[model samples]
Target: MWRQSHKPTKLFHRAQRCRPRALALLALFLVASTLLLCGIKGKPSSQYDPPKLKRSRTRTSTQFRPTVEYTNGTDLIWQIPESPKAVLFIAHGCNGRAANFWDRSPGCPYCVGFPEERLIVLHALDRRFAVLSISSSRKCWSLGKEKHVVKWITTWWIERNKLEKLPIMALGASSGGYFVSALAAEMRYKSIVLMIAEGVFDTMGIPEGYPPTLFVHMPKDQRRMRLIERNMEALRRKGVRVKEVRCLEFPLSPNFLSDRILGLNQTMAVKLIRMFSEKGFLDENGYMRKDGRATRWKQALRERGFPLEKYELLNHIQEELNLAYGYHEMTSLQTDDIFDWFESYMN
Candidate 1:
């Protein structure tokens, strides 16, 4: 009867409070133990790890495939190798496309049977270079406009390939050489290889702090060589480094008939005939008669703002003939030498 109306004892109240506190402590202990077990299970094993690195194989050959990009109406053909050490910008001659310079194709009407272009590309790929061939939009290069286009293309290429710190080189033949010369004066190119660059030095003045230049020419390419030498002298005067390599020497053989009747080397003969025909020195049938009055080359030089004496003019004409005839042959023969020279500066 007394228990029915009883108030809770102090001991019972204390026991009830301790029961809630104990339950809370037990829940906290369970949570801590669960977290400790999860941490131990989640620890990484020594055998497996994240953030893996990838290895890429070195590409040895371009074969026939190249990535083509069209920017600013110019075709930029790229033959890029893995881990490129340097960059080579190639500008083809007048009426020449990027394909003709990267590969020895039959489309180039002026030259035949020269695999130097193909070989150069292959060698560059082997050397781990990102080679670029820039095609002119028109029949010939417009230096003023093409210069900016080339710069833009190259800058884009280097950025895309992550080659911002690599050394840059330029190679050009004939008119392409002229373009490269102008570009080199404007930009900071490591070096330039010019093959049969006619009147480039006269057209583009040697800039202060110009890059080291390698002029490749035939020993008989007197006119262009004279111009190159004059430019080299000017560069020297301005304290710029330069080198010239006279390739494909064609010395007259002891055989009198071969030397005289053959009319210079075969390359020279073809070039001379073509030059004479172009300058109106030959008949309509492409015949050069001995009695034809020589064009006043010195007067023409003066008219073009190149002031040279009569004797110098005659020598210049002869040199021009030599260059016109022998350029293709000389370029073909000296392709390896060009690569070697370029290699020296790449380091």
Candidate 2:
């Protein structure tokens, strides 16, 4: 029979058809994915899924920063906060250490507390459970080598561990002003607050359009206080945040102004800090009621022993405001609100 060679059987025809390659490939992929999941089950959470980073609660917010590292072998009087996130690196004035910046001391009139590290922490609590302490550097500044150190500390810390990338704020009163200014000028810091501080910057030559800075120099007494006003205005024009607090006691108060040459105790320092930093702590007219009686700020200074007449904080309210990590008898630093402003400032 001319049946062209026997027709192939149905089974033979089906065998010649293409294999289920698509289905087999899909099955292989599914198996591989399952293996990956099973393998990851033995790994740490961080390996399988990264840890969530802590971001600023607000465009401005505060939180504790743990796991910090100090670079340049610099010795800091570091104090972890009761709560944390905000850090204050205080540069001491001439003949000063971080300890000398308190307000009240005995035998000295107008003093309420001995400069203590704890009070700084206390002041920062209102802003957030923050930490305020100084690092011991010898008249160092951000103008030159000091600037390198500032960058090193920040970079070193970031590379060293996993802490929220909260930037540090620089502050200094009197002699410590130089460091603060240099830092503001050189480093990529969050911001800076200069209290009764400013002078010829020994090392800073930063051009315009640098980090946002705040200069709060003595309005009445610091030498060059009035002169720097023009520069301060210029900085504001450059978009730098600046506020010159006119000490009601200044000019009226002596130049070496000691609102509190030294401190009385932490208790008293706490009270004055509240009075000065908090808005409502002082009346709308800038007077705080005493026992429901009206009291002038200078008079109150006298009552508290911060006699505006003889307390000398700076020779040229301007020169001593430098912050070159020098020694300090004490610091008249603004309270935690300085940090609160930082939140809004950075945001």
Candidate 3:
């Protein structure tokens, strides 16, 4: 009977050892199953594919598929069609966003119409060029602050889109023009287009080994145009290929009359007259009568020795009061021509 009891005790000890091992094995199995399930669930669906290269149907009607991304606290909106041959980077002017380039809402400050945007973007895509529009971090571009960041983002984008071997061109307007000009000094670009660029380049000095550049401006903006021409001349002197296109003609809208005159309240009008008189564009008598006629202003500009023949004078009085109005008018008229010029160098 004692031997029998010993046998039962031995069996009990063996069972105890096996039970712990069994529990451990069961726990491990459960963990493995859980991990396997997670792997299956987390896998990306085959139906959801990544962006693919698409062939453009026609130059005039190529469709653009735009995507927006945020990198290093900057907004980069880009359109990459299939197998792009090159890339174009566009910098927006002061208080402008990437969306402003494509957005055509009435509220958009510098809205280019949808038809125009389509024509430009699609034409680029058809020619196998990816387009990127970058917005500034602040109200205006700060090249010192944003240049490195922009460079990194642009490089990353080129790699991500498999456009490693492609050439890059830049286009900018106003403050954006200033940004690109500064950037060109640091980075290599195939070409650059500047529209109504600021006079910042004079202070900075034109950098050596800069790329070919095209400057587009309104003739009536004598101060800014003179600055651009001066820079262009300097670039030419350096043996850099540079060209300037003066948008001498513009069509004015009927509502432009209201925008020039009635848009300003009596208080604003009085202030404008005072400013104009101080600029010597109006005599004290003309200022007193609030004479905003083109004829009178032309006489003032002529007396100042401004080359009137170089400018296409619209039949309106308000052109003398606002330089921006004149600039915008030219932009509308010359959008297609600008694109054509850009295309000319793409080859």
Candidate 4:
């Protein structure tokens, strides 16, 4: 009886020792399962994605496509919103084409519109404006002859659409700005927005009925600043209503690109920011130190295993960097202000 009792006591002691090991294994498995469920097995929890915001559907969200046509050896890319109240003529900078303000559509596959340009177009479309763009025949706009061509195209489009009574407006960037300023002298526009280009009123007198003009510029270029100032003074002297927007340099945050551009994940954004910092392209405050076009940042990114095939990502980064430097480039930062100025003249 004593031996049997001693055996049971030893078995009880053995079971107690094994119980802790079983519990430890169970606890470890639970932890691993939790990590797997949270998708933190390979990636850190800090990099976990947040909930995505639902984008409100717009009338033209899925159906907003541009049409491409040719007239007199010039390519015309255009879109008209339902019940358009006005017609907007968009002119691109030097070396840019008519498709610069539109995305690649089934109708126009060759279109390579930048985000800045696309945003501007969308803003105009949302306001029920018929947008039209014409390619320059040469490398830059031929103001002498193109103005007549533009007038003919405008008349044809207006008569075809039966929108002869709608207000006409024009927005141009860089060399295109010069073109529009010259075109305005010959034609009557309800309003004109010139970006990074001074008017040529010095050579030609500002008409008594000169349209209201809005000048968008970067003050960093002292020579261009003086020219724009001269243009503003000339317009004011003619009693033509004028407004100006001075685009200033802005710093980049971790989510700067991700916020403005789509398909760019926060992880990649953070990585790019860090890489820029390490490569001496970004200063301590995340502001670009040098012109992005001149830097070897693209090559450096390729070396760091960034996906160079993603051209959209590359383009957005390049544009944002240049914008941060406040260099002479196209911008959509003041799209609302631009449209507001245009509408104020409509009445």
What are the per-residue Cα lDDT tens digits for candidate 4 across 221-337? 779989988888889999998877766565554445655554565445655666788998877655678877887899997796545675555776777677767777887766767
- As a whole number from 0 to 100, the lDDT of residue 173 in candidate 2 is 58
How much lDDT does candidate 1 score? Answer: 0.56
Model 4's lDDT to the true fold? 0.74
* Shift of residue 230 alpha carbon in model 3, Å: 0.8
* Candidate 2 ranges with C-alpha deviation above 4 Å: 1-73, 99-113, 116-118, 129-142, 154-161, 199-209, 250-337
Report every candidate's CA lDDT: 0.56, 0.41, 0.56, 0.74
- Of candidates 4 and 1, the better by TM-score: 4
Show the lowest summed lDDT stretch of 10 residues, model 3: 33-42
Candidate 1 residue lDDT tens string, 80-137: 7888888999887776777654432333332211234555566677777789887898
| Candidate 1, residue 177: lDDT | 83
Worst ten in a row by lDDT for model 1: 49-58
Listed in order, each prediction's TM-score against the native is 0.57, 0.48, 0.57, 0.79
Which residue pairs in candidate 3 have backbone atoms (N, alpha carbon, C) closer than 3 angstroms, thus clashing? 53-82, 54-82
- Measured with C-alpha atoms, the lDDT of residue 318 in candidate 4 is 77
RMSD each, Å: 36.3, 30.0, 30.8, 17.1
Clash count, predicted structure 3 = 2
